[model samples]
Target: MRKLTWGVWLGTSMLLAACGGSGGSQDSGLEPPPQDPRFVADNAQWREERRERLLQPDGWASLVGLHRLELNAHYVGSGATNGIRLAKGPEKLGLLQQSGGRVWLVPERGVALTLDGEPVKARFELKPDTDQSPSIVGFDEGNGQLSLLQRSGGKALRVKHADAETRTQFGTLEYWPADAGWRIDASFVPHATPRTLEIMDITSQLQALPNPGVVEFERDGARYRLEALEGEEGGLFLVFADRTSGHESYGPGRYLYTDAPDRSGAVVVDFNRAYNPPCAFTDYATCPLPPHENRMDLAVTAGEKRYRRPTP
Candidate 1:
């Protein structure tokens, strides 16, 4: 874990104190459930389920390699001579050929692979994730899988191995205590014309994601707003940061997703549900950074804390 400099810690402490001080608006009549035994137990159960999902064979933690495809043919394997060398698996996996914006995966002789659980002995077209039914090639007897991913205006082979070191050696997640006070009622301010936000990902690639509107809420008497991105599931996605960002939380920011607004155009901005981006867990993930407008002046002392991997 990276230690926070004294100056940074002091600045964060001052910001937290200011945000929690008397300058904020009065309580908005929203009452949260008491912090009883049942409440604690429920939160514990949720965290457990989250951990289980992370350790899944194909989850983010299983990511082992991300190899950008070239315009020409390339050999993919664990061998050093291969164009895309994998960290694990057979020395000679297959060959990836790209032409005319299309990719094909040609299997090596006697190198067994499965497509939809059926043996694949011949070459087949590989579709990027942008397609509805992209090809998923299974190798290493289902322990390793490969798929085409469209990223940064190009295609790449994403490799997932069940025995990925990160997944096998994952440390427990830490969090600030579950505090219902962090759940605030917010109003959705829709834009007459929806726009696109240029989100810069960890890979330094810019993507234009949908910007539906803004969510306005008050905390500690001070009002704040966060631009909401249209979620794939008809919900709203928020990438934001506060004073806790560089000190007690993931330095970049945290992500939150909320259901669509109700009839009254009201949504609940639950900071308690804020979670660290996939980048926090694995370096292979390409996570979007928070936009300038989404950064908050106040401190959000809720949600998951900085994940410090346990020492060996």
Candidate 2:
């Protein structure tokens, strides 16, 4: 297969200078380079799964539009059915509806939540935002609730709550290949406890995520490290860029999730699961950007490659 090229996703990131390196550039001292040229098969599997996520029954590729329901209104937007705004299936767009200071769905039944666009059947139980989890995945069609991304990642939306409109507008996730070289059997360097790291994003604004620690992996004969961000359910969220970036891949970077490593520091940093940020699919999202230290100099040739965004 052809050699994979990783690209920078969000913006022009200048190399980080704080990490132990020579001015965000080539190293004169780490381990030697690689001896082979193939991305491992395990890596490819991740990509296929990610692809299915976006194009299959429920992927982002099916996204049509993110209709903002108007508060105090009962009808769907213009030209919609019975004023019940509906998010279209794998082909159409749904209208956002608001009634009695709350958002309601069309029929509140037949309409489905597009996982990536296949239409998942469900509804958002409205609730008021408090310190507790806003969207606790409850069953009551109560008042004061919404999945507002800005007002807390839409706390009202629970896991598998259904009626997720974005699921329909999903775009396809592209990639180079699942190469073994990109699948690093990482060794985790633990911290005393989960530490809150102040990191910046694609927009140069600092965002906070509980970072567990660092993971060291080998590629092209060199040992590189990436700081893992903590996600819900003890999952590890990682953001990194490599040589292939800015060339064959997206210019900003890619994102990945991994199970927290074992005691011996053995965790599979699979690139196949690497996916495009929400920004890649829709503009209504405040997707977090990768940090400076997370940038890698080598090419990660696995995972969700890029989104083949068509002209709108």
Candidate 3:
């Protein structure tokens, strides 16, 4: 991934200013109470940490290619003849063969690759991301990584290279000014029985994700609710949109992860920490769209703004 340059960091304030000011005061026509200094400092720190993570070698910025595997065996390499072409690395990398709902990798004669730090000299099963222990094949002296990702009942090879142009040319992450009003306290109302929500991704594939409950909150004297997807980490994953979508933010939506409700059924829905999905940075990402139930009519002028990809 690209290094987080000092220019990007210095330009953050300017970008935020250009985007606009705190929407709360302007929308409500009433000045909000002064934010606590501690809250402002903590929020700034969180945004900084989020930026650092995105610049990591294996983060979303490193994603350079996504190739769907054919039912039959096919060569994969940087060569033009290969069925699956890589943007960088060896010319003749390997062969991907699919049979009986399983996929295997067969490295080229002179190519070297490793799985779990052990040299792979023979054909081995390649596990998809859905597997408990997915196999990550590394090559190019560990600067490139490859893994199978299952989507729409099919498998695709996700390729990540440290030297990807996208990573090297990362620009800035825009945002609106932090406002305490956007940090709302919501009521988590659990469902009597667990339910499922059919979420559609940018690829038009539908996934029946778990819907654990609903979070109800009020803003500007208007009530709203957002369906929460049960998170793998005992939290709640929210894919939502408001009036800001397609105008000031990513067109599809944004994502938010909040801790599970407390005993009293309370969860802090901090829009200040809401972030754009992976699709905002790279076209290779398969990000889910916000469910209809989670869409709001009000303008949520917090969190991340639309990303402008840097020139290569």
Scanning candidate 3 in windows of ten residues, the lowest lDDT window is 1-10
- The models' CA-based lDDT, in order, is 0.80, 0.50, 0.81
TM-score of 3: 0.88
Give the distance in Å from residue 90's predicted Cα in candidate 1 to where it truly belongs.
Answer: 1.0
Model 1 pairs in collision: 24-220, 24-221, 25-221
Looking at model 3, the pairs that clash are none
lDDT tens digits by residue: candidate 2, 209-240:
78888877776677778888885576688877
lDDT of 3 by residue, 158-182 (tens): 9988898778888899887788889
Candidate 2 contains a number of clashing pairs equal to 57
Give the residue spans of candidate 3 off by over 4 A.
Answer: 1-33
Compare candidates 1 and 3 on lDDT and give the better one.
3
Root-mean-square deviation (CA) per prediction: 7.1, 9.7, 8.4
Estimate the lDDT of model 1: 0.80
The candidate 1 region of ten consecutive residues with least summed lDDT is 18-27
Alpha-carbon error at 145 in model 3, in Å? 0.8
TM-score (all chains, Cα) for each model: 0.87, 0.57, 0.88
Compose the digit string of candidate 1's lDDT tens values, residues 13-93. 334432432223322456545776775677778778878888899888898988888659999999999999998888998
